[model samples]
Target chain A: MDAIVVSRLTKHYGAALAVSDISFSVPAGSTLGLLGGNGAGKTTTIAMLLGLLLPTSGSIRILGHDMARDRFAALARMNFSSPYVALPHRLSVTENLRVYAHLYDVPNTERRIRELADELDLHELLDRPAGELSAGQKTRVALAKSLINRPDVLLLDEPTASLDPDTGDMVRGWLERYRAATGCTFLLASHNMAEVERLCSDVLMLKRGAIVDRGTPGELLDRYQRDGLEEVFLDIARDRRPEMVP
Target chain B: MRPALRRVWGMVYRHLALYRRSWPRLLELAYWPTFQMLIWGFTASFFAQRLGNGGAAGVGVAAMGMLLSGVLLWEVALRTQMGLAVGFLEEIWSRNLGHVFVSPLRPWELVAALIVMSVLRMLGGVLPAVLLAWALYAFDLFAPGPVVVLFIANLMVMGWSVSLGVVSLILRHGAGAEALAWTVLFGLTPFSAVFYPVAVLPAYLRPVAWALPSSHVFEGMRAVIGPDAIGPDAIGPGAILWHELAWATGLNLAWLAAACLLFAGQFKAARTRGALLSIGE
Candidate 1:
């Protein structure tokens, strides 16, 4: 079964439709890129998938568990990362990690936390308050928090944002290795086309709360005659031919 | 044996971390309570003088109660609302509201943490207020021992019951509703009989005060401390014990059960409305 199965999932804020009749699925152990404009509803769809927002209509089955009615059962095996949601600012990195560790009920939490700190180059940051960290460091900490439970399904929103190029590449490399090792599914919402090209197996391009096109990175490039994912992103944003909603 | 302590330890560590960042903000939370107490201490002591309850003895009693119960109940009330207000506000400001709630931690666990921290804060706040009431106003500070301890327990129960509704209102209507909490809370005070005997309340208002947990708190506290401060003349021992204990025991049990239900319902409602994460990072 797919790791995340969404169908006719719609969300409305008053008369405005944030995500309207959207549908997609990520096969277990695969990565899917969610692309959209400033208000194309990528975040809303993600919120629904995470059970943060109840859908105005339709259904979502994530990791074989119903998100609407049985979110906790599925949430046990899932985790998410985003810079926007920060850990307590005054909390040190280790303390922040401990909160999630307890919440996730991770076995050998101290050991797991140590492993993440070493893997993410966060050893020196363990004692620093979370708000004291630089933006890039915060990104890595957020990633560590997401992985604290060693989830089977990882939902990341701009997981590598604001990192040095070297660090960003290292993060991507680590994510790839982790996915390879655990076969965990990743649903990443990102603006980094190069990162998208590097990590995502398939792309689902969204426009105004609906999918305009979806295919493998290579397929989209070949079909649009674009040199890279960035070109394809631009074309979609411009509503150009090859990715035109029609 | 070890595990429960470990869980409690973990909960303490987490709040300690949060306090590290929020210490400055918390100073802001304290400002209002301090000001509120100063006004009560200064103004109510004025009234304490005119009532013949105004002798140096009366001034001392009034000042002591203002310092003691004022700081005590106010601290309890402040801490509970702070937990709800700041906790919910923390979720909203962090933009991680979705991430935190989506994890295995239920909302009650979150609320419980806030209450636990609030309790600690209440204890911390009381120490200084008591000393100041003595140094500044020559108030008789009777040592409470176990009686004061029971009063602390009642303070938490009553404080949180009211705060749950306050927090729930904030979650549902957004922080704009926060202004209403104080106005509502203040209006409750006169009816609560926090300053005087509930019997003194008008015939109609007497029942209102009877229904309040604070009425019990003031009554209970008076029983314990009044004897030391006023000797046998202040109020009957049996009547004081019955009234105070009745409010503490009877009201706490009823309010606790009702508060738990309301808290759970608020949790479910906040989740459905996407307000849980709205309170988190």
Candidate 2:
């Protein structure tokens, strides 16, 4: 079974549809990049997948568990990370990690926390309150939190958006290493085209709440006749839907 | 060791961690109730002195007793209400609600955790005030015996009921409705007869006061304490205490049931509207 499956998923905020008929699947041990511009339903899709928002219609399956019916089973093995969401501000970094570690029921929590702190270079900041961390540090903490569960399916939204280029690259590298080591599937929603190109096996591009295009990075580049994913993204953003071989 | 209990304990430990590391937070837990006790204690003393010398010794002691009990007992309700609501608001302020909901934690578990924390917070705030009342005014809120326990429990549940309703509003409308956390309980105060007897209320407002379970508790308190002050029974103690307990148990339970249903509906609506994750933001 796929790590994540979403079919005909629709979310409407009253009269306005936020995510419309979006369908996709991510095979186990592969990364799928969800690309979209402002109001393009990337966050909405993530929210639905996390069961934070109920879809107006359709379904989500994570790790073969139907989210609407068996969400806790799926949630027990899945984790989400977004820089916009945060840990409790007054708690120390280690305190924050311990809470999630307990919630996820991670065995040998102390050892796991130590490993994450060492791997993320968070050992120095572990004693500092979460509110006191710089944006870059907070991003790393969020990444560590998402990994605390050692989730089978990881969903990340704009994970490195707050970091400098060096830190962003490092985070991406760490994610690559983690995925390679654990064989966890990832659904990443990001605007960084180069990052997506570097990590994703497949890309799903959303336009106005609908999946306008989807393919492998090289395939999309070849079809759009562009040298890079950035140019192709612009083409979609500008509504210049490229001709397809069908 | 069950996973569900472990998850609930994780939430409790999370809030406790916040309380542990911050002195200001700890100070806040005891400050307001202590402040209220001091103010009311002095006011009660002043009334007792003036009226004792004014040839109405019985009226003076009764007034002092009512005021002192009113202030302390009211904390049971206030702290419980604040505990549940503020505990919820903390997640929103920290932008951690998304992280919490994404976990395997169920909504009912969240409610259970909040209620447990409310009990802890209520004790933390009220106990200090209780001690201070003893040191300063020689008034033992515990003097009412085992019935005080029931009285406290009833008030806390009533507070929880109203707190849940307030939280539901905050969930639906976001931070703009946060003031309800502090204000909603106070709105019910006049009707509760916390400072005065139900008989003091205007005839038209009397029915509204009678509907409040807290009104009965305070009235029972007056009956329990009144005879000692006046040298004659104001109301029969046995009849009033049991009657008040029965009314409070029933009314507070109904309030709690309604609040839970309201909260469930509000949570569903908020999740559907995508309001849960963005509540404080």
Candidate 3:
């Protein structure tokens, strides 16, 4: 069964259309990449999926529960993380994680915290306030928080945006390992084409609040007659029609 | 523990942990209430001595007690409102509302956690003032007897109602409306009859003052602590106390229900506007 299923999703901010009617599904345990430039409705779509923003019209089902009527049930098995949203600055990493663990009702909380601490390399930062951490450190802590529940589905917005190349690669590797170990479904929205190509089994390209093109990364590269997703992304973003293959 | 209560506690613990590590944050909770108590306590003493010089020592003592009680009880309402408003603001400032609302935590569960935190913060801030009023002024806020509990409880409910209104405003208008959190109750103070009886207001304003549950509470405080209660044997708070208490309770219930409705509507509006995720920004 699909971990997430969105049907006829649309959102309007006053008279302005933010997300037009769009529909897609992510099967359980698969990673799907959502690519768009700013204001392409990626954030709005993600927000609607998380039930943070009510769609003007449409329905969302996550893990077999309707978001409108039974969001809390699905929310218990899902988690979201974004660089734009932060944990409390004054809280220590451990305090933040513990609070989320409790919020998620994770049993054996301390042991789970210790395990995440080890995996996220948060030992040195556990006692330090979140506001004091460097950007890369904060990203790792945010990741740890998102995983505190051992969610079946994770929605990540720019999961590795601020990291240096080495740290970014390391986080990507950790995410790869995490998925391998847990079979967690991922819905990732990011500007990094390389990250999407490396991780996403399927890709959805959004423009002006509508899905413009979608396929596997290799298929997109071939269809656009490009060497990489970046070139394909540029073509789509610039509204260049893909070359016809006869 | 039940999962729902555990979630509420987790939210409460998040705020408590902030105070646990930060002495400044802890101290801030008590500072204003203590300072307000000191200032008002001394002012009440001066007026009492003036009344004593006029051959009304008995009335003077009673007035002093009532004034001090007014100051302390008013602080209860102020602190409770601030506690709840500031707790909600903390989530917005941290940009944590997105994370919070996305979890299994329901809107009502968040409200429950906030109510608990408000009471805890109220105690942290007001207990110090209560202790100082007793230690320095020999003013027992509890002198009005068991009815004092009812008085404080009524004020707390009123505070929560006002805070809900303020939070709803913040939700609808975003951070630009945050000043209402601190200043809204103060705007109601004159109309609340905190330092005086509703009778003292001009005829047109008396009805406005009487509309506030807090006015009834303060009026009730005066009735229980009036000059007739000079001796221990004369310390019976009569039917007037119960009459005022009933009015306060009924009004508080009405106000609380209205505030809750307003908050629910605003919360829905916030979700529609996508304000919850971007409020602080």
Candidate 4:
């Protein structure tokens, strides 16, 4: 079963088109990379899927629930994280987690919090206010929050955007383990080609509010005649469309 | 507990945690109301002494009671409105509204949580002023009897209604419209007749004053306080009190409905525009 299915989704901001008739689906337990430049509608697509933004047209179904009519049910089974968004600054990490645990209606709240703390290595930072945390620390806390409910689906936008190389690798490894352990579906939006190549089984490249191409990392590399996704991304972004071998 | 109520409680808990740890936040809640009480209290004392010098000590005491009551009760409406608006603004300021809406919590559940938070904050701010009014000046806000509860309920509903309107404006126009949250109700005060009877308004503005539920509430308060509290022309205090109360209730119902509708419409527009994720200071 597919965990997410978006059909011809279109969004416009007045006369400006933010997302234009994009369609895709992610199989249950699979990781799908959304690769794009700035204002490529990656965030807009994610927002619509999360029911935070209304689509100008088209439909979204998550875990078989239609986002327009039955979003709350689907939302209960899904969660998202972004470095750009933040938890309340005044709230401690524990308080923030406790609040989200309750919001998600997680049973055994304290036990779940402890489990996340252990997994995220947040024991030292649990008492610290969210605003005081460094960018790296905030990213971990956000990841912990996204997993608080043990969601069937998780959306991540720039999951490691600000982390140092070592910390970013650690986070990427953690995500791999978490996905393997729970078989949770992931829709990751990132400019980090290495992160996408390492984690995404398949990737969709977006440009100007539409999907320009899609394939596995290996397949895209071969098609673009490049050794890395960054080179392929540069080619696509610079409008250097290679001819199809077929 | 049901999941919906738990979600509401979760939102409430988030704000409660902010207050619990921060002394400055807690102090801010009570500071303005107390300060307003002291200013009005001293002013009322001066007027009462003037009336006593004219050999109308009874009138002076009655006037003082009315002034003090008006100050305290107006704070209820003001604080309640601010409580709800500021609670919402905190989410925006922290850039947490997207995180909140992405949760399973419904919009109505958020509204319920905010209403509960507003009442908590209103009591936190106004209760101290009530105590000080009684302690420093022999004025008991509760002296007019159980009817005071009805007055408070009406004013609180009015406060929530006004807040709903302010929140809707913010949703439509973003943070640029936030000043309305603090200043809108103050603009309405001239028409609310808080410290004076509605009859004192210019004849042409009487209908405009009567249109607001608060005017009815204050008028009812004066009628219940004494026979001539409003004026000698005041007839049948019981009838006037009940009449004003009825008007207040009806007007509040209409205002609340309109405010809810306005908020719902603007909320939908915000979603379509993707403002929820982007709106913040």
Best by TM-score: 4
Which is the winner by lDDT between candidate 1 and candidate 3? 3
What are the interface RMSDs of all the models? 3.2, 0.7, 0.7, 0.6
- Place model 1 in a CAPRI quality band: acceptable
- DockQ for all models, in order? 0.44, 0.84, 0.88, 0.91
Where is model 3 more than 4 Å wrong at Cα?
Answer: A244-246, B229-240
Error of 1 at A164 (Å): 3.0
- Write down the lDDT that model 2 would get: 0.89
Return the lDDT, model 2, position A155: 95
Q: Sorted by lDDT, highest first, which candidate order results?
A: 4, 3, 2, 1
Writing each residue's lDDT as its tens digit, candidate 2 over A10-115 gives: 9999899899998899999999999989999999999999999999999999999999999999999999999999899999999899888888888888899999
Candidate 1 stretches with Cα past 4 Å from truth are A241-246, B1-12, B20-74, B80-84, B91-96, B130-150, B177-187, B202-207, B223-235, B241-244, B247-269, B277-281
Q: State residue A220's C-alpha deviation in candidate 4, in Å.
A: 0.4
lDDT of 4 at B91: 91
Which run of 10 residues does model 1 chain B get worst, by summed lDDT?
B1-10
Q: After superposition, how far is residue B61 of candidate 1 from its true place, in Å?
A: 5.6
> What is the DockQ ranking, best to worst?
4, 3, 2, 1
TM-score quality measure for candidate 1? 0.84
Best by DockQ: 4
lDDT of 4 by residue, B52-168 (tens): 898865677778887888899999999999999988998999999999999999888998999999999999999999999889997899877789999999999999999999999
For model 2, the interface Cα RMSD in angstroms equals 0.7
Q: What's the CA error at residue B229 for candidate 1, in Å?
A: 12
